[model samples]
Target chain A: MRGSKAVVGVYSYLDDLLKGIADIRSADLDYKVYSPAYRHEIEEATLPGKSSVRRFTLTGGIIGCTFGWTLAILCSLDWPLRVSAKDIVSPPGFFVIGYECTILFGALATLGSLLLYCGLPNFLRKVGYDPRFSRDKFGLVVGCDGHNLEDVKGRLMKSGADEVNVTEGI
Target chain B: MSKQSEKKEVSYAMVNDLVLRMLEPPGAGWWVLLLTCITLLSWGAVSFAYQLWAGYGMAGNAHPIGWGTYITNFVFWVGIAHSGTLISAVLYLFRAKFRMPIYRLAEAMTVFAVMTAGLFPLIHVGRPWMALWLMPYPNERALWPNFRSPLLWDVFAVSTYFTVSAVFFFVGLVPDIAAARDRAKTFFRKMLYGVASLGWTGNNTQWKHFIAAYLLFAGLATPLVVSVHSVVSWDFAMSIVPGWHATIFPPYFVAGAIFSGVAMVMTLIIPLRKVFKLEPLIREEHFDAMSKLILLTSSIVAYAYITEFYVAWYSNNMFERFQFWFRPFGEFAVAFWGMAFCNCIAPLALWYGPLRRNIAFLFVLSIIINIGMWLERFNIIFTSLAREYIPAAWGSYNFSWVEIGITFGAFGWFGMWMTLFIKFFPAVAITEIKEILPPPVRNKESLQGHH
Candidate 1:
């Protein structure tokens, strides 16, 4: 397991590193990119698409609206107590509750979907992580066979990686 | 690649060093402050316990003036909570780059202030255990909280605001927590950071989802910044009380909330930046920008004050007119005049550029405005209820020592939480600042030379 994956490149500048990723993409090497901050360059180079998180927000809002209206209406109907001659089920008043629920559920759903998508709360520490990536440095973990380890290391070094770490056996 | 700005260069290591330094153990001075807050908080707890034992009569509540200092404190703290969302969500949506350094503290303040505000209603209700009745959960009684009631609306609005804001705050912390985790030397610190970080790897995939989720939350929270305070306003406006029942309550409350919120932010951050040596990160420009907002909102609040009186006179409603007149010349004249001076007049100083830039002036002004905002609430609650429609029911209410102690305790509680938060978590958003920074200087030469 330890002899499988090969090199990790720590780049100080995001632009050069992103270009390095573009080069890796052209070569079709399996790789992971890490940065301290979210960068559009990385997004364009790597995960290029509209995030699917929006669907969760939309669906959650719909569910929330339905839940809000249904709950308010059902509760009113259950009691059937007419207050101040108003109707039992007041849609106008319930709209406030519905609006609040929409935001509440939508935010919750967004957070839930985010955690699900990111595979977060993972207690186990995965290998091939460089501590410097959490600081100023950008990191690339390129998966390589024994034969391509040297080639991958050289490619990352040539692309202006400040330092490259070689790890063996996954 | 986007062209880098030729601004003062900041490296990621510099940010890490500056922010993570806050996570170090507190000094003797910090311990002294924490101890004082804890002492005050304990006194507040004792006061509350006494209230629980002695009953609501311990506070100043009688015939016409059923609502008193408790309600005033509730509204004040809620108003204080509003600025955080405005700075964090509204400013974020507008792409205010300066919000990066200070928004984290403001957001934390919002959460803690709301927590303090939430306690008031529970205490006001007297039977704290039965306060859960405000919730719409299914029960054997087959009764639901009255949705038509503004108080019930407040229940949903405030709770929703709290939940969303807390989640938003924590979401922003994920990356910073990971940074802290990597830098942790002690095993205990490492374990704590590791769990809190939620296995954040800062990979492109995580960043993508994080940003998307953050944007959605910001959008969701933006409306809440308006709605929460609006619903809180309706608690007064929906009533038939003269000063309380105004059509202008919603926007007026929103503006005042933001006004007081910014003032409170200034109150907290002025000292914090000095203590943490975050002057570089939280620049003078940020203070200038915030002061401008404070000025804008204060003007709106001042306008609301005038409009309230104008509408009262224009309507030719005797009670409304009397209420407005009574505010300035009546029993609570001192409070009304003080509020006007502090809220309306004091903020006028910011009109001068030098005053806004002067940290001493801004700090003093912020304290004065906070006092003015509190008085504003006090005047509204006390004056309106004291002299309502029925003359026979007219009564004056005074603050009992118990209520005063409890209010002080709320402040202590809020301060204590914030002090602890600053110690454990990065008060500033590390990742956000990194995003806005010019590309690292050392890295730039190496990369450009290669190209």
Candidate 2:
């Protein structure tokens, strides 16, 4: 983002990280938290409400269920090649295809939603990134105006940020 | 030995280093193994090429045994795939902590096994190139594949299983791949990890969705694991073949799949734990837990075997009765009895806790169970087809070099992928292992005075 300034807080301990998150929240600033692994405590502290990935799964499953049956039934009717003298539209037989499609599509959609929400393949968006975030360190990035940049950095340092930096144009 | 003590000792950085170490440049042993796999794969490929050149008659598949060695190989490999999903998805949902260290490799095994299994159908079709006709694509003829046919169900089920599994496997690898990307030295490896990781930074937004999506994938996959084998079972059960037409084939096949799959996991992981020196992470307790699963599934399989016989007798059907009798006393009696000893009797040793925990014993038993499982499928496919409803129409399968070569190649194929995977990817999950470890915490006294 052009002209945007942010304060980055790097921490060594989970306790300090949670405290850092508390400080950012109390200030009512827009912030993003980073960690090496998923923690229920961090999730409970930083994010509100549940992830919307479930909606994508439900939508994909419904679409897949519809598509599977339509493809099976309509194709069977179009061809009209009866095997074993079974019914023209065999729901029992098609149920297997439908079930498999539901899972296949649901899984694909879940992956899609994850990518979209996470801004994945984001090769160029690395203004506040730290390699240690993937290893042992936790980070807290709070986006604020240039005027509030020093104030935010000071607060983050007091909030137990082992290292704090101000980055412009992030 | 308690998990609590182990959790305290392992650090996040150590988990990263230990896992990434496996991704280091291969040693001589690894190259030799890779060469062996490649050589075997080439031999299988040569056999297949020769078969394609000479015609379908090059293989032993004949009048009565149309679904011969190729089908057996297909079912065998698909069975090998079951334990991966069972461990990664099902155990994950149940919060089985032992799965943490081994599930990554298990999931990789599942994807590669499915890839190997997917090839058999193409190879079985003989023409191989015409396999695309199996899909429900638009054509000038306006004819779709018969959805009512269990064969068509196999196509859909297997393809769906493969797609979902590969997706699940890759999704789980993202964070670990990111870790590898950060530590990667070589430019090629760095680029590979960078692209594969999708630039994951472990932000809370990403973790929140990643966790949710992973949970949903596991839920979707658990039922998929059961349905896939069941659909594979329907390929046989839907037929009027005496040995295969039983109602119990779904659960029987599924339990057998898990039995064989878990055995395969043990087969792979025992060697892996030693080679990678991951004993601290993949402990004896994990094997013990896995053995218990094998024991449970083995009992189910044994019951299925007896039930097949009892049902055959109770049905008063001459063909079914004859099929059951011939399985134990006929030309392929060795396969039936071998399967019985390996699958039913061998796993009984696991009921003894000491044997389960003994890594050496588990490794040997795993190989035995795998052999027995292959024999079980062979017994079901070959014996059942070798003598069907009519004695005059019945004929034995011709053991041809083509099928043998192809079967050997299939193992090479699976082995080659596995050998390469361990060297390239973090065989052990870096992130999940760290997740289970106690997080670094500042002292409460120090924190109490802060904010």
Candidate 3:
């Protein structure tokens, strides 16, 4: 819940959504912060950790393509093929298409992964989201209920959320 | 708020205002106009008129060689177009700082060069009216072009290249267009720039998409420089002519294309930088870098030359060997030496830093190099064919006034187009220059260290 609902929070103490609720006494009122396991996986993949598939997009793609393609064509030599009285692996014939396909696949994979990493489609994004988020608010979110909302408002004030507001309907 | 953001736009006609000072020649030399450009344009024009009336055969071309000066020029101009994409896309991908001014000029050169090139295929047509038949379709006329032909592949390659280069050129021009749109007093310029700008607001998201499209187009078009010329080379390689049938032709041609294209760029830019007072913008550093490239490609070009001769010698196929070696010593020797001197020898002046930085020396050298490169093409095509496999079939080409006229007029046409373009449009990309300049001296206090 700390990273969810279009909010990014960096907490000084353990007043963050998960920790605050876990430590809630009877006087603190009731609440829960969703922490699904897959959230951790996505959070780990994105933003935080060094371990990632993203780094392989360009370099790994090039290596896999060139050597992979060279092996494929070289192995095809044993499969006896003849077109117009020409031998299979005469060395000169293999260079042209071999070089062309290697570049083609490497370029294609790099292009695809670059798109995924950037999260870019539809070409435009919403800006100037909320005024309060710029001033003193470290994080602002929508949808905190009234009972827990009041108690949550107090916690937010204590934690310096700046200007907390009730967010019910769209 | 939207209305207020629009008001802060600044406009200035930077440095020289050549059009306003009409009497003076805007610092550009008279010799450039008289020689390379003007001569070429007018000769091509007169020849074109003769061509329209009498037909293409008047250009000294006969049954065995139906294509002549026009086809050669097409290859030359298309080769010239490569450097713009090379500088803009490849260097941009590599983040080379020297590309800034030259890149835009290269694109302009590309568009003009392609325009000049596309004319030849039409003019060379046996039936000019049937030119549209090359467009891909299975038509009711119950005819289709041979799909297997390299000529048709050229149709795809060139058209794709033109579209992509044109888009890349315009996408990069948006900021400059916005500036022009703001400053333009006339309705036509305002409207033209307005439409060209496409409401570019310089917001971060707009920049993201704009750059994405630009880089994408550049990447797509980059290999085409190699592909287009290689495919063109295949037209010769795919042939059964002894000297022409070598497997080495594609890479050889590609290397030659790059070599010549850089030579052409040097020829154009040396004069332009002088005339426009762009010494600061198109700096000595830029010259040094290109001179190195010119030298490098020249050596590659020279290397290709040696290999062609050596292979012809080593192959032990007597007809092939004689056809290759006899080129420099025989009838085409002048063209062969001219090619060698221009591409290989002339650029060697760049070995010294002083010569590399000297605009006048570089300018003269570039001209010589272009001549050599042009001769290189003439040598390759004519020499190989003039002495084909059988001696009985051997014949030589002598250019008639008609052929000479068309060649002259092609240059004239290119000059007229380039001359007009430079006259009206802001020749330099101003806004881009502003962006690249070391972050502006924010305030007086910030400038303290410089003093």
Candidate 4:
């Protein structure tokens, strides 16, 4: 992966980092933020749209419930036992299996969506990632062509970035 | 870059260092604990092998008391598993910030306890190879497991619980694993942490999806906390046996489960906090909050007991009344009273602030509660079955050496897994603690409009 962005600013304080990102945003410079922790401020600033993971959860739950009911009812019909003079299609017993499957499938779907949305299991590490981004430092990777590289770096530095490193790609 | 004019009191850098330090290789004491657990676990494996060779007859189970110590231990461990989901998932949904430090351990306990609990039914069945028949797969024999049986429901419930809990535990560990990956000093360590972390970058987009998925899991697991134990309870309640067939069993079992589970967590965290020196993260305030939860659950369990006895008397059923009466005054009366005293009377100590805060007192009390909870299952299973409808078929069961060894082995199994987990994974949620800490103050001029 070639890094097109030149400036990577690390900040000790989240507010300073957010301010720096906001200043860069004003210049319409494309950037991505990284933090050691999940900060609501960062999410609100960078990715404000609603997540789509819940749709997968709902779809998975529906399929699970239907499958559970179908399996129970079909298995009983196949056996065709007249135990205790009760109906072969026992809704009560089927509901238990269905309830469990709903949770099982819903949880699995959530995991699937998490992996898909997060772009995980990428054996190859992305380029231009700072090690300290996973520790205390919050990093803002700004994308800039050579014409605006110095301009973006100066803005982040003036916005109180602890360190500003100019990388070639991203 | 120029340094800030004033020094920041605390920084995320310090938090990362303290939390990640726990993931280092074990000390001498941890190794000793692991070896002891492994030895005990090996003894348990030997006992299981013997049981396999000797058949179910080797267990103390007999005609009337068909279910014995194995089932008792099964129920106890299942109950012990509940508090983890309760603390991790349920408490998370409720927005309990205090759960941050200890929830990971509780979730780990849930997974391990369920794994241990899964072994019991197979062990109890004697024919371990035939246990595969419990699965719902299509077979050439044209036979299906009895869906009407709560036992079958248990097969589904417990397995689902294990899967969900394990996934939840791993999902929560991702950021921590990434943190570990960054700090890895060796190539082997980096590669291991790298795979475990799955290339987590902690970017804004990933956090958005991560939080969403995590919340969904919390929501999914919360129902499981209620349904799994309720299903376990139905294994008894759905039966025709006196003292077992009660509508109240679901809530009763659920409360008892949380009661025992919380005690187990206390038992674990007290020793862990001391050994790991995690006082700042797992403070006295956390214990105070947890003890109060224990008190609440204990009271519920106590109320369930009284209501159970009252219902037995009011029903005017001779068998039910006898079963209830026999519990406190019959052959298992000692166990019955011990259970009541330990589960109901012992947790009352937490109501006092001094006792709740007293580490030694709480630790001992937690152990006592575990014992009581175990006895509670024993009394419930044995007394009712021994003196059932047929007096001629009445019999008593003694815990044979096999069952005793297996029980000890289960503990060893749980302990060994946990010992390794603490050494490898972040014992506490490092990413979460960073979020919980107040962010550093910034200059008003630079941050004025953003806030």
Candidate 5:
């Protein structure tokens, strides 16, 4: 967002994309990488930390579990209606409901965390996006000052960018 | 692995095209099939309306057989939903590569099948409008649903299963939907895919969270899948009725559910693959793997069948023994025998390696397995209730035309969702399929040049 111009590198091969990412990192340019599919090699190259989505899942599951048991136990005790001479508060039966809630809440939370972290429905800014990136291409987008834009473009091309485009204001 | 990719010769762009092409304007056949589904769904709707008007007696539920075809269909559809989760979530945890192409379809099946299954309990209750009372919300009467009852457990389990599976299905669809959005030419399609894809760009951050969350969904779903069917089984097993009360019912029902579900998957995929010309993606190897699964589950089901009979005899309980005896020898012997043939005997043909890979044989066998699974449920529900402890209390369920129409209509309901899904969304996972393909890489010379 600080830069007035950005350099975009379109890559057909993953190897070239990785090389470009390495170059941009060395040059200390803020950049983003895009791919047609998830790849471990890209993750290894980009070095984004482990996603925190798991924390959301764990927290959601625990809350769901607690809520499930409380609801079931409280509802059972409220009436104190005994059937089949079973216990007044049945953990065994309630466990089924609790287990299901754990999954339901866990999954919904994961989705919420994914959307929040990924900045989805991002209609505000779509700079440097290419349709081919969703099909077969890898894209490296580097934001830089207008004066340094040529240097960034040169570095990307040297690292093996198939095509490079420089646009004003990313 | 590189050599394998070289031999197969598929690329990322080709994968996108292959799957996205399925979302194109439908052909005559698709329209014809869609029309057929609507016609059948109308039949089911009219039947249900008549049942509502005429009273619960319009169907077969009478005397001891209070639960009839509606309950049977409920179990059947729920069982059918099991395979979707098994393939989509369980196989994913195993990192089974063969599931890459077919799991999307199976996951969709799981969602739609559960939607179809959720309707039955309402239909069975005779007062579909008052179904909300089953929920534990605070009421004016201050009456809470019985927490210990297996029926109450079912409301929680099945609803949770549907929610989780639908979320899993949609999460997997997001990236593929983005791919479709890129290829879409029409304005309405543009907005639809734009919103549905949630503006996915498959960037590093998006893929990072996406992969992490997807793994967690799979992990959570795997246990839930097993538990959901077990809860469904407990609705019968918790009852004191001789044949219904058994510890083995959980595993028995789970295996049978997967067996029938995988067959249902085959029943769907064979025709879909042919029509879409997805032979290279959904290869014989996938079907071979699916058939082996059917074989494994069929063996378990057959063993459970034997165990049911053995336990009945070994327990020295005459009621249990009589229920087991009457299943194959009494008035409903045809259903029991038919289930035995379809569930136990029919899948034995898959033992042959050649037949396991044969598409036509698998399709026919899948339909037979589905029918057999349905009959298996029918036998369990009808036979146990028909002759309980006292002979004087014995009864038979009368199958009315309404029941038959509604049963066929459930298929229409399921089929209608599937038909519309295939047209609007990417029925196959474009991104996952591309993930398995060789990454687009420059020649060795180019890599050395970069270094």
Candidate 6:
């Protein structure tokens, strides 16, 4: 293990390439996980061990709906107009607004919540390199600047990664 | 994926029998075709023609009660429509699996209910020809529509809701339409589902795009539904009559909408599910889950009812105070308590888990809820107005037979739409149900070697 920086073009790996790498304290390995149109790597490196940005719970959706409804109601109160001889604050009359607000607020809030939580941008940019990953291959690309780059690559090969590749990021 | 598939066993046969039953000719329960729906529907329409030819007097508009039975039915129908979106988009987004059997039909209900609702305002208008004024158009008249007007809001809310839900419903139906497309041998059927499916091929890419678009529409629509009903609630809440003004009306009305809607869905779906042999697919489990929701919504509505009365009492305002007290003890006390029995008291039947699970009990409860929701609307609209701001303006609202005709006509319109949908499309989304089936039940033989 020696050197400042190096990139290994990991075309493929044996199933047990890292099975024999033993008695090492630790290694600093920077892995970038990418998937093509069809399949992406499992992205173990990117997944937060403690906390994650990607969440699918509906609580966020519900809160957003409720909040949106509350906001719409808050906005509607600006001018409580009289209609057809009835006072503006009647509870039965508010039924229409409440109903409308609930539907609008709940639905819009859910949409807004989903967009925020899903981490979706206007566009998904594509990164190049990795053909076998398209056909059920988990690509593990490790960027390291030490003499043990090969050793790190070897470790991933043993961790059930069918192919290992080093690709340039956009 | 394999483990997920292995997690639960769902005998597809449980639902298969339903499809097979639907495939069979409907049995000898001809009363549904003759006496109940058809008779009621035509009777209503024929009555409506007379209403239009004559005047608003047939339905008992009288002098004080400008709005009568038609408005009550309008609000009632609007309330009845909430469960469709609640089940299809809202519950689906929440991943409530029990919603599967009822989603399509519920969505159909939303569309039909809105259709029926849109009719009443027109019928109630003195000059139906002027209904075009409801539209925001660049006409010669410089007058602007009062945006603050809840009636205008209904125009926006109901139209938006109906349009969006129809799209959402159709989008979800695409895959099923594709399935129907594949299964269909006839020219018209193939053309119908083909165009409806929008050239869908079950490629993963297509499915992804279709799902994404459908999700987007659902997200867009979920709010419109809340907005629609909140607007409806606001129509009442914005009024200053004794019982009409309260802050809780929005949430309370929404709860009632969902409560009543779910009940209506239950009423229609239970019969359809049974007749179509869908008991296995719709399942006791689904009914159990729905019963719990019925209980929850019922509780919220009941809470709203109490909160309303409490606020009226605490406010100590004579007008508001008189509204609540007079409602229970006045000449209309029988009707007031009747509303309570239908909306509030009867739902307690769901408190027992066994009763909630009982299809017959739930069926009866569903009927009661509908009856109660209708009365609740009647009480809200008529009770407050029957006794006017001045004792001189005080007068009772009564529905003449002509008024009754338009009311029933509205129901006929709703049922006709539903009947048409059933004749054309499969009521259940077969593929979606298959997707949600627990793995073992999905692949019945997949568990042989697992120790």
Q: What is the Cα-based TM-score of model 6?
A: 0.71
lDDT, candidate 1, B1-451, per-residue tens: 2213313645678889999998998899789889889888988999999999998899877778888888899999999999999999999999999799999999999999999999999989889999998898899887888887789889999999999999999999999999999999899889989999998989888899999999999999999999999999999998889999998999999999999999999999999899999877887778899999999999999999999999999999999999999999999999999999999999998999988888988999999999999999999899999999988888897778889889999988998999899998989999999988765534555444333
Give the clashing pairs for model 1: A1-A169, A1-A170, A2-A168, A2-A169, A2-A170, A3-A169
* Better candidate by TM-score, 2 or 5: 5
Tell me the tens digit of each residue's lDDT in model 4 across B22-117.
877668999899999999999899999998888878788887888888899899999999999999999998999889889989999999999898
What lDDT score goes with residue A90 in model 3?
A: 42
* DockQ class, candidate 4: medium
Q: Which whole-number lDDT from 0 to 100 does residue B304 have in model 1? A: 96
Give the top-scoring candidate (TM-score).
5
Q: What docking grade applies to model 1?
A: medium
| Alpha-carbon runs more than 4 Å astray in model 3 | A1-170, B1-43, B441-451
lDDT of 3 by residue, B114-217 (tens): 77778778777756678899864546865444333467656656765676677667667665655555456677776776676554433222334344544555
Q: Per-residue alpha-carbon lDDT of model 6 for B283-386, expressed as tens digits?
A: 77788888888889989988888887899889988777777877788767877788788887888877787887788888988998888888888878887887
Give DockQ per model, in order: 0.64, 0.69, 0.03, 0.72, 0.72, 0.04
lDDT of 2 by residue, B166-254 (tens): 99999999999999999999999999999998888899989999999999999999998899999999999999998999899999999
Ten-residue region with minimum lDDT total, candidate 5 chain B: B442-451
What DockQ was computed for model 5?
0.72
Per-prediction TM-score, chain B alone: 0.96, 0.97, 0.88, 0.96, 0.97, 0.91
**Each candidate's TM vs. the true structure?**
0.97, 0.97, 0.69, 0.96, 0.98, 0.71
Error of 3 at B180 (Å): 1.5
Estimate, for each residue in A1-170, the C-alpha lDDT of model 1 and write its tens digit.
Answer: 23487588989877669768987888898888899888876887898898999999999999998988888888888778887788888887788899899999999999999999998888774557777888988988888888888888888988888989888755
lDDT of 6 at A66: 61
Top-down TM-score ranking? 5, 2, 1, 4, 6, 3
